[model samples]
Each structure stands twice: as structure tokens, then as C-alpha cells.
Target: MRTATSIDVVDHDRRRLLRGALAITVAGAAGLLPAYPGVAAGGDAIRPFRVNVPEEDLAELRRRVLATRWPDRETVNDQSQGIPLAKIKPLIAYWGTGYDWRKAEAKLNALPQFMTEIDGVDIHFIHVRSKHPDALPVIITHGWPGSVFENLKVIGPLTDPTAHGGHAEDAFDVIIPSMPGYGFSGKPTDTGWGPDRIARAWAELMKRLGYTRYVAQGGDWGSPVSSAMARLAPAGLLGIHINLPAIVPPEIAAVLAVGGPAPAGLSEKERATFDAFIAAAKMGNRTYAAMMGSRPQTIGYAITDSPAGLAAWMLGHPGFTHWTYDSSDPEKSPDEVLDDVTLYWLTNSAVSSARLYWEYDGGRSPAFAAGEKTAEISLPVAITVFPGESYRAPETWARRAYRNLMYFHEVDKGGHFAAWEQPELFSTELRAAFKPLRAAK
Candidate 1:
């Protein structure tokens, strides 16, 4: 029953007009009917928003973190029993003593953030327009255990490419949205807010912003949402790029599903991928997924109340649990991870966000859902396979899935959180991936 506090004051005149325009545009889009209660009576408003969490909330979060009951250290050594107390201790210590939520708030407030009602929920997003004229518009979606915070680092590089070792033509108007029930976005009251639904909402969002042609990108849950957008192929959606492209073939899927061995006719890389996937699955690290997908509400009580509990669950979740997949050096520090966890705690979105798993591919590992009912995408598609991903998608599988595959690359490092972990490489990939599609402008 936790509700987000709204700003008391708003620019009545401007927000009213903007909502009117959005309402008019979406009236005809059958799939994007808005049912959310907070929309201005006159229209489907895209209101300008700012992040200003109250002082008491911050104080309460620290109190909870410090007041956490300690759990005994794991019996076995190593991560064999999941993230040991050894890992949790440092994270909790930093969260309680060293972490600063205000700085994170200030960084978020510096960005141009907004909220707009789409398909019965208020969607929060960060929109940064590139200064370069004719900059391609791109919508970047973040996944579970992540928010728009995950994509923050890449904003400067993607929107202002010139300053980040890229030509002006490489710039993009970046849009990072907080999925419904995550971050400042409103939680859904009913079912059906899955990737497909979110994709339609993104299309409506871009149209509201007057983007005639744009590209989409994401990793983790973002991959499925971006893929859904491509399949919808609205008038302006030109292409999509995803790091965790779920491109497993039916044969591989069947083998994995039945706990069977790799099929006889596979190449060396394919066989290796199958083996690695099977091995990763056997580790039994997906207990979080099972809980969230089946009973988000049950777990919500614990995470909503205990900041430490939330951090532990997120830190050890199957979706990119480690600080970084790169073995040499960590791509993200413990502090960065705390910021993300704190945001979730403050918003009380752990349960609501976890509910998204139930909506689509419930309790199933992202790799296990091969031949799922996916919309056929005819638009140009681009994919990047990072070294540290759960399972690298083979080029053969990607080519087979996407009809108009324009670009595909395998980078040296980075895992599930590519944009957050390696903004430079991520920005470079975006520049190259959509280079061909930009000509459509």
C-alpha cells in the first residue's frame, strides 16, 4: 500500500497543454489506451518531473540499514552457497556508513526527467536531446534489479557523442524509462504490463516526443522490451540493439528444457555455449526468480521493510549478481550498487518490480524460453555479445532470428549491465549499430 509522494506544485498551463496533445495522439492507438487515475482530466499528460525525496525517508533508510539483524556466515567457502556474508558485510557496511543518497538524488535531478501516463500507468523516463542536429532518437530500457539509474552513465556519451570520442553525427537523443513499478514510475494496478505492453508504451512515448524515426537499445529486460518494439514496427521505429539478445534456437531450447545433452550437429562454439549454459543453470542461483515470479507479494514485505534484505536479494539475484562479470577489475564499485539498491528501497518497488517477472517468462531463465510467442521483427536489427553475459548468443542463432540483421559484434568485456559497466564501449557500439539506420532520416 506504499504510495509515492507527488510534487505539490506543477506548471498548470504547460502540463495541461502537453497532456492534451498526448491524449489526442493516443486516442486512435488502440493498444495504448490509458486507464491510470492520475492523468489530468483534460488529457494524457506528459508532465515534467523532478526527484526530491523527503529528508525523513533518507533518515529512515539509514536507520533500517543499521538496525538490520545479522545472519550467520555461510557454512561453505566461496559463492557456492550464494553471496556469502563476506560480500554482504562490506555492502551493508558501506550502505550504512559511507553511502550518500543525496548525491545520487542530485545526479538524477540534473537530468531532464519526466512522467507520462501510458497504457494505464504513469511511466517515468529520462530524456536527453543531443545537441547535434539530426541526432537519432533512441529509447533505452533498463531491466529488473535496475532502474533508469543503470543507464545514467551512457547518457553523456550517447546524447553528446562529440565529447565522448565520437563524431557529432553519432549523437542520439537518449530516452531512459523506468519500467512501470520501478523507480518513480507508478505501479500497475492490474496485470498485462509485460515487455510487449511496455514496448507499445515506448512507441507512444516516442510519438508524444515527436520522434518520427528512432532506434531502441537495452540489456537484460531491456532486450525483450526493445525486441517487442521492433516487432510492433510502428511508423518511426527503425531498428533495435540488444546485449542480452535471447536468440536461443528451438533445438537448443528443447535440449536445455529436458535436461538433455547437446544435439549431435552443433559447431564447436555452439556446443561450448550449450555446455556453459547448462553449467550456469545447475548452480541453483535462480531462487530469487522463482520467488518473485510466483509470489512477489510475499517477498515484498521483507524487501520493503529491510534495506539490508533488499540489498542481499539484489546482490545475489540470478540477473547479473556479481559486481562485474569482468574478472580483471570490477566495472562497478560497491557504492554504485548501493545507489541502485537504495533507490529501490526508497521507492518501495521491490515487490512491484518483481511482479514484472510474473507478467512475462515467469520463473523461467531468460535462456530457457526459446520459441516463445515472439513477434516477428522485419526491421533492421543489431546485437552485441559481451564476454561476461550469462550466455553469449551465437551469430548463427542471431542471424536466424532477426531477418534484417545489420550489425553484430562480440566485445572484449562487460556483462548484463553493459551500459552501466562500460559506457565507452556501449556508446561506441550504439554509434556503429545504428549508423545505417540513421540514413532513414
Candidate 2:
């Protein structure tokens, strides 16, 4: 997931009015009301959608790639400056000559993709119903620098556990939505489309889909959204399982913010984790967060226009590639990373996506900020802390953060992009985390 900036909050009432009008327009076009089906005479409709970028569009993307103005090499020998030119050159070469968007499109179209209006934005999602009659419904969200593509690898294993190693009862009917302003989803013209609002939209979305009972799962930005969903505790929200659990305690966050050392009484492991986070922060590795949160629109012009620029911007983030398996190996390929960048480029969502950063405080990481403001999630909460993640919250912090921590485990493999990096492991974690919730409403 990629995030940098947060747009300053605008008036909520005005944004609501605009969304209401959009809802009416969408509803009338589909011969339905903007409200959920059960609540009104005319109900909102979920329409099937296809990913079909015209040939000319693909050609233009290629043309833009070949026409890019090359930049001089950095003064440093390594990534100390940023993504080296050597790393980006081959990626652009493959993107221009070899990569096939059609393959990606076919993969998505093969699944059940749909579009629906939710709080004014047209939410695009893949809804795959499990063959198992008793399969649980789960809405999985993608993070920034990511799209529905991030969760694609796990779709089959999750929805058809029988085909994998699990029994029929472990199946999950998956719902992976492109966040508003990302990928095929409609962008918010006004402000106020942050994770909190997105959570409400998710709740309304599940209800509209006729799913009165469901659980939520996500990592990276997905974690914050899922956390919000759990906090909102919507009717019939079974529980939430997050790989990147945003469970940093507030005192630790305050200390880190001030460049102060870890509090005096922490254990060796807990203190070491906090110390590592502070060290990374001081290294200026997360400057992108400050930039995006403060001035996403300004940076948007460059990223939106330049394909290489967009790719590098994404790669510049630490632990993003580790989201891919064997990311550290020199023999590792850039296929998955290119796929993510291509989606952002084709969608022209550089600026729109960056605006997501503007919704919160500029300096702090979203995970820590999430801890500071979010109320303790009293419902069942499960967490999987992967070793490769930038911040692997100690169990102590997680328990303090989540009032009802049903499950917590430290997986040997995977990273920030856990689900995408290790689908098999990711799927197994979900099956175990939500097993108890299966019997609930």
C-alpha cells in the first residue's frame, strides 16, 4: 500500500450534498433509488463492470513511456538518494514492450466485478461468491500504491478453500473494492473521502449487497479502514482481521514523536521495536508521508504525467517491495511492482490518490495516528505481524490497543504487502483468525 499526504478537511455538509446529488443521478440512470434496497421503495443497484482500456489508451501509455525525459544519475552509489536509474530503466523497458494489460484485465473480468454508488462515489469491487453454501462474507480493502490487484493472488484460496488445503466450511465470499479515487472506482471531486468515511461506505455497501453479516480484512491502508469498520461496529459486522495491525500504544507514539527514547519500563523486545521505528523516522525514509499529507496535489502533476516518476515514487517507499516475495533478491523481477504503477498511471489517479494523505496529521505514520485517535475495538480482533514489516507491533502493544484481541501471531514470512506477497500464508491466517466468528451472526 502507498500513502503520503492528507488533504485538509473541507466542510462535511457540502460534501454530503454533492454526494446526495450524485446518488440521485446514479439511481435514476439505473432505475433505482440511492438508498439501500431494504430501506426504500427504489433501492440502489449494483451493476456489473468491465475493465476495458481502449487500444489507443494503451498505445498512448507506451508512447509516453518511450518519450520520457531521462534524468541524470544520482551522486550516491546506492538507493541513499532514491530508486536508482538502473532499477527503473528495465521496468520501463518491460512496461513499454512486454507487459500485457489484457492479461490483468482478463484475470479481473474472469471474476465477478461490479460497480455501485456509495455515498456519492461509484465503488468498483470484485465480488466472488463461494461455492460453499455456508461461506463467510468478507470485504477486503487494498491500500495506496496498491489496488484490487494486490489481493488478486489470494482470491481463489480464500473463496474456495476446498480447492486449496482447507475444507468447504473455511470458504469466504470475497469483496475487494478499489478505494474511491483508485483504479476503476470513481474519484471524489470534493474532500472528506478518508478511511473513516470509506468505512461507513463499506458498511452501506455490504448491506446493499444483502450481506447482513460479514467480517473485514486488510493491511497497510486497509488496516486503518478495517480498524475504522471495527470501531464503528456496524450492525452484523462479525469482526475484523488485519495483517498490519495499527496497534501502537499512544505513549510510545508520543515518545517517538519527540525523538525521545522508549519509555523506561518496557521489555527488551518492545523497546527494541520502538527504537527501530524512531531510527527509521530519523533517517528521513518516510519523507514521502509528510510530502503527500501536506501537498499531494502539487506532487500529483509530476506523478500523473510521468510513468517513470510514478514508478520510482512507489518504489521509493521502504517495505513496499517486500510486499512482493523475494523482493531482496537481485534475481527478483519487477512484474508485480510495475502492475501497481501501471494501474495508477492508466487511472490518472496520481493526484486523486495522493489526496488521501491529506485527511490526517502530516508528520505521524497512519498506524500510530490510528492508535492515538481510534477507540479500542471491543469486538473480536485478530492480528498477524509479519517479520518484514517496517513496524511489527509487539503483542503487548496489540493487546493494549485492541480490547478484545482474539488472535495474535507472528508469522515467519511475508511483509507489508503480506496478502500479495504470501497468499497461502495470508489465506491460512484469515481462516484461523475468523474461525470463531463463523458461528456468530
lDDT of 1 by residue, 161-248 (tens): 8899999999999889999888778777778888889999988888878778899998888888888888888878999998877677
CA displacement after TM-score superposition, residue 441 of candidate 1 (Å): 5.2
Clashing pairs in 1: none
Each candidate: what lDDT?
0.78, 0.78
The deviation in Å at residue 17 for candidate 2 is 26
RMSD of 2: 6.3
What is candidate 2's local distance difference test score? 0.78
What tens digits encode model 2's per-residue C-alpha lDDT throughout 1-441?
A: 222232213223223322322232444446532233433333366766666666766788899888878899888876668777866787788888888877777777787777788886778888888889988999999887778888998899999998889989999989999998887777786778888899999999898877888999988788888988988889979999987776667777788888986789998878878887887877677887789999998888798788888988987888663333234642234666777787788777777778888875553576663543445577889999888888778888778777788999998988877887788999999999999999995
